[model samples]
Target: MSDVLQSAFNAFLEELKNSESLIRLTVSTLLLILVVAVSRFLLRRFIRRNIQSSEMRRRWLIQLRNILLIVLVLGLVVIWGHELRTFALSMVAIAVALVIATKELILCVSGALIKGGARSFNIGDRIQVKEFRGDVIDQNLLTTTILEVGPGRSMQQRSGRMVVLPNSLFASEAVINESYSQDFVLHTFSVPFLRQHEWRPAKQKLLELAQKHSEPYLEQAKRHFARLSYRTGLEQPVVEPRVTIQLQCAEELHLIVRLPTKEHDRNQTEQAILAELFADDDYLGDYLPRV
Candidate 1:
């Protein structure tokens, strides 16, 4: 056992001689001891001269000693910073390799980070990504839950289904945040009709109906949009009602109506306009035909 101990001690001495980091650390420790001794001697002399009360002198001594210790520790850290950094980087690389082993989980985490960094959407905000459109109900690192909101964009009512989408999709897909405007938005819907020669009168009447329905909040929308434009440095968008004629095919015409309406009342406002337009025989019977 004594021979074994001697051999072990000899091995340790050999290692200590060869290890440059250990040698530097030992020298740095001795320097730190000298620095501490000098600092404490000066601190006691300064405190003795400045402080009148014994308790105050004691407190000063303690505080100065603590400061000296902290400085020594920080100096030691700075002296060995390169090694610490290398060790830290090695640990990080191992962690990254472990994370990449689970591809889906890493993707999900990456996507969550992307979403957070982008501030794309939040709880209760309506968003659309690819075929998925819904109000964000809950979100976690792995998945986002949305209360499904449509058979299509034209229909804005809830479908009473919950969709759990893997956050990974956000990395690949474009996200449309519908509630970004918060208060009001320009809502558009297509009104299809058979190709007719005299489409002007129907267009005029439809515009009039839209103007009537949206007249109540048109000024407010204009103000909001103006502020939004100023704050965002974007061009102020048209807030008034407008209609554009589009040729769906050789035999079909689509009258696209766009109007600014309150975000929450978008569907209701659109439904009201369509209901009124269809209920009137003059508007539907003479000009428009259902596709």
Candidate 2:
């Protein structure tokens, strides 16, 4: 048994010395694997030390490490192609064809990966990509699902349609996440009426309604903005209800109320505002836009 082991060991050494391809393959594999392992370890340590409280950033870092490993492995295989030039060239040609055929798919997947890694937006967040505005309902490798929203009585209400947007669009288009850093979005609605000398009572009445309707949101927004300001170092905007009068036309005036509210509650809030306004005064109810 010892003699057999010795003979096997001798044969292994002889092969190691004579087989250039075997040596290259073994050394390259070990070295490349070590590099990958070290890189991952260092990256994880760095993330742990520097990145705090962001699960998305941690996920992104891990994904980037995996991608680095894949690219490194592929490049190493290509580098060791001298021993099997024909096979390597054939594989390369096939890869090129596949890339060409699935270029859009590749781009879409890449976009998804990038978007996910960046934590660009999450489910239930209101986002706009180009002209499409909606709450992101689902997201995967190829597409994002949204409940569509548009301008109407309530400027931010859902349009009762589902839009499946390809992830590829994220690569070329801009993304605006309304609830990215804050839980509430600033909402605006205008009540237009003819300008008259006796408009003070109506104007004061509208301002009271704006404050009453937005009271719940006002307190919540202040707490949210305080944290957001500290985190982002941005100047915090006042979270109280604001009523600004704008001249719409020579004969008309606009009372635009800006308030912070949850995007999901905007439709209901608009309806509530209208109901109260109509109940309080018959004149403005006739002129207000129909819900």
Candidate 3:
């Protein structure tokens, strides 16, 4: 009985030693590939079904899913055939080669991850980073896409043209999020008048119009500002609608109306204000130059 047991154990060891390791590795690799493919397909479907917001879904599908899938595949590969030492050395060599060969890409991707993780901006948010100002349309591992907006030709308006910018630029540049924390941002409009006109009535009327137009946003902004101030141990400024008149070009009176406005509605609000101003000549007649 002892000889039979020894013989069986030795046969088992010999079989393991003489087994075609390459064949095993190939089979394992094929299985890993198949698992990854199926997982990706199922994950995509699950994400689509579970994520309600289109923007959030796009981000998860494009960025998060790919990262998880890669990690899983790598883990399976290491477990299937490679020894820990061999895997560690291979990974270190790959990392070194990646650092040397794709330094810029690595920096950009890493910067993007940091920025995204910090919640610096989100899709549809208006952001100004460096010379590029636009609505964020897409964010990826290395780049953040913008639907450019502004005056110059370089400023691609919301005309669907996308500008892809490397995320590393944020490290060196100041980033301004127009719709940060709050949906509405302050929009100021300037109306020029002759210096001789009494500005009080016009200013009052402008303030009233601004309040009327932005009543909802003003209320919300005031509450948000108050909370923020309290949290930061600062005194909150009195939240009221107001207009300031400034002397410009030595002769013209610049009546500036500052009000809360949605980013997309800024142009519309400006046009509406101008239309209202023109429609009521009596209100604006005091500011007109004397013939």
TM-score of each: 0.64, 0.60, 0.55
List model 2 lDDT by residue over 1-291, tens digit each.
345445555655575568667866878878887888888888777878887878967786879788887878686767565545644454566667668878989989988987987788999898889888899999999999999888533466778999999999898888988776546767778877786533556567767887888786688778888888889899997778777889978998887877777767776776777688768555544456645
Off by over 4 Å in 2: 1-96, 151-154, 194-201, 247-253, 282-291
Native RMSD of candidate 2 (Å):
17.4
Clashes of 3: 1
- For model 1, state the Cα shift of residue 44 in Å: 29
Model 1 stretches with alpha carbons more than 4 Å out: 1-97, 197-199, 282-291
Q: Roughly what TM-score does model 3 have, to 2 decimal places?
A: 0.55
Comparing 1 and 2 on lDDT, the stronger one: 1
1-291: candidate 1 lDDT, tens digit per residue? 345445555655675567678877778878887988898898899899989999989998889889988998898788777656655565565566566677898899889999999999989888998999999999999999999999998778899999999999999899999988878888888888777545566788679889999998899999999999999899999888999999989988988999999888878988888787767544444455645
lDDT of 3 at 37: 77
Better TM-score candidate (2, 3): 2
- TM-score order, best first, reads 1, 2, 3
lDDT of 2: 0.76
lDDT by candidate, in order shown:
0.84, 0.76, 0.73
lDDT pick, better of 2 and 3: 2
